[model samples]
Target: MNRRAFATLDRPYKNKTTLDLLNSLAVMKFSKIKPLVSAFPTLINMNNNAVNCLIKKTLFPVFCGGETIKQTIPTMRKFRESNIKTVLALAIEADVDELERKGTDAVSYTRKMVDDLKVCIDGASKFSDNFMAVKFTALVPPGLLKRWSFNLKKLQDHFELVSTDGLLSRSNVSLVQDAFPNLDASIFDKCDELSFSDITAAVSIFGPNAHQLILNDPLSVDADDIETFQLLLNEIKDICEYAQQKKVNLIMDAEHDYFTPAIDDIIIGLARKYPQGFIYQTYQMYLKTGFERMKRDLLRLEKEGVAMGVKLVRGAYMDHERHYAKMNGLASPINETLKQTNDQYNAAVEYLIANNVPLFIASHNEDSIAKACKLIGPNSNVRFGQLMGMQDSITFKLAQGGYNVYKYVPYGPVPVVMQYLYRRAQENREMMNRLDKDKRYILTELKTRSLFK
Candidate 1:
């Protein structure tokens, strides 16, 4: 490895303007205080014009792409200059809370969100090698998503919840009695006696074809949830189909565990249709079962002869997940320590590389990245990703090394995207040491420019 490629002062920071450095410095310093981190959402919601202006002028410019598609063009162009592509995410489109706030207008709001995403697809199609993130949270009710997750997890005891690959290729396809080969059909017969409800019982909840269902089972079903669920499925299909028509890739982001199983089901089902890396599923490797999930996905995809499009992230919901598990009296799903998370994340990275899987390694950890760089050959079907405004040095370093890299650029109104900013702050608080290193890098660059002179 070229040591300078991993160095902090490797010229990536050298081009940052004084204002940009100052903004990063402010955010980094603020992240060190736990109370402030906890109160970040409240502060953003205070609704004061002055504070919002300051944030817009300072932190917003540094971290976010912009509030609109037009605003994000500059960000995309700037990153393109660095040999980086953009993963444009519409932060406002999928917030369930915001949709709830729209109460009387909820239906219209959801439609508008979907339309906005269409606009995003149209805009993104103009740029090659760029992708967008889609979350159907606003389209599907959160509580219902959780219910599907619970119901599917129970069903998953027999097989993973996704409809198997190749569900789209054949014309005379028929639903089967078993999704898993050799797993006795009798297992589907043991619903009532198990006490927690079996596959048959799930038919009442998810509808009749539940026996062959993974989480998203049955091409047709008679159930209330399935009806609403079909709306969400239709929306995703329409959106993704349009994207594919326009020749753009769309990444399906992973959400909370309570909602992810159903999302996973839908994503994998779509992955079967959009199998040329046009649709990617994200795997957050902070959870204890992270490695297992990737292994299962890889195995199934290979067995079914489907292409893989994976984005391995270090995870963004550590605090939220841990708290949810604690309050619900469940085992914390997160790894017990940072080292464990890094280990699990790296293991998943190694697993993908070993399988020659097409992947996007999205992390800020240099050691993990260096390890990936060392393990994979030059022609590997691998790319790199890091969030915009975070990890500039490593991102630039990887791009400089002739690797395909993307900056995850989030865009939405400042107030509407507060949850995202709060997560970024929480991420910063947890990564105090990393923030210190970034601050040092900025300070060093400032000194090198000699504004003091």
Candidate 2:
């Protein structure tokens, strides 16, 4: 790939005033300072008044779409003009206090979240066929998921024993009986009837040492936990239905490993139910098992006649995952080296293209992007994606080259998205360095324009 082909400073900055260009350069230069401020709470609060003013003028415009969907339309239009698309993401973190207050009676909370998500979908759909990305954790309470995951782990252990015994019965009645001896038999009858053959087939698909039968749509949680699980599913189903009705694609954001299995189960279930590529699950390539998981999921969906949609990403949550693994004394699930991650990521791109799976190749790395561009055919259902503020060069160049490209534009209240901003800064150091390079290009452009005038 020609590095010069990816140079996009002038084209991306065409709408910007000289001050806007300089301010963006200043923000990138000062990106390191925000992490320092975040580390010291006292310092952050003490200088909030001034810092907020500075952030609004500099950081906010570059990164976020806007505080609300209506406010984001103009930015979306700008991307359209550049022959790029927008995946408007609502960056609201889950409110723990509100979820706790709703407690077991989450009807009101569920309704509110669905309503809010519908607004985001409706607003985003106006700009493109691809719509908003919603964090499942934002819609469902993390505590409820934690409780469900805890119980599901026990159920998985029991199923593992059953799988070891090699029983191939008409229904999972035997597995359920052994797994939940305490629960009513009626509940087992009520659970989705998966035969022993189905279990064996799924296990074969997932390969050895995979979590056993935890992918059961309504996982075998306790009676009380069932209500919360159903409620969460109902919210997801509602949002997905609305998205489908609007002819918009919904991308479910992946969370930590603890929550990923359940999230995957929900997304796969939705994919099977809705079919026709309405929903996509994100795969984080940094995980050691990510390629295997993606391969298994694609095969499973293919067998079920469900059209699979995917967004491939280099995993976030690396620091948190490593810390959690070390604290628990479990083997870290992530790739041990950057090279391993890059290799797996590129391989995943190959697999998706070869399998003819619809994919969003979400990366800022030029090498990866160029590799994907080479593999993608004229009729390939693939698109390049970069985050809103960063990677302007890569995003614009891909568009200029006639490849489908998108910006993951996040929008929410500033205070609520502070963590989002910090993560963006931390995760995109290479892009930050590129921004330093971009500053020189911008300066050169400014000088040329001045001389021409």
Residues 331-408, candidate 1: write the lDDT tens digits. 998888889989888888888888888888988898898888877775788888988878777787776667778998
- Angstrom error of the Cα, residue 441, model 1: value is 2.2
Candidate 2 stretches greater than 4 Å from native:
1-17, 33-51, 95-104, 151-221, 430-441, 451-453
**Candidate 1, which segments miss by more than 4 Å at Cα?**
1-9, 93-110, 157-222
Q: For each candidate, what TM-score against the reference? A: 0.83, 0.82
Model 1 lDDT, residue 381, Cα: 81
Compared with the true structure, all predictions reach lDDT values of 0.70, 0.70
- Supply the TM-score for candidate 1: 0.83
At residue 140, what lDDT does model 1 achieve? 63
The residue-level lDDT of candidate 1 at 295 comes to 73
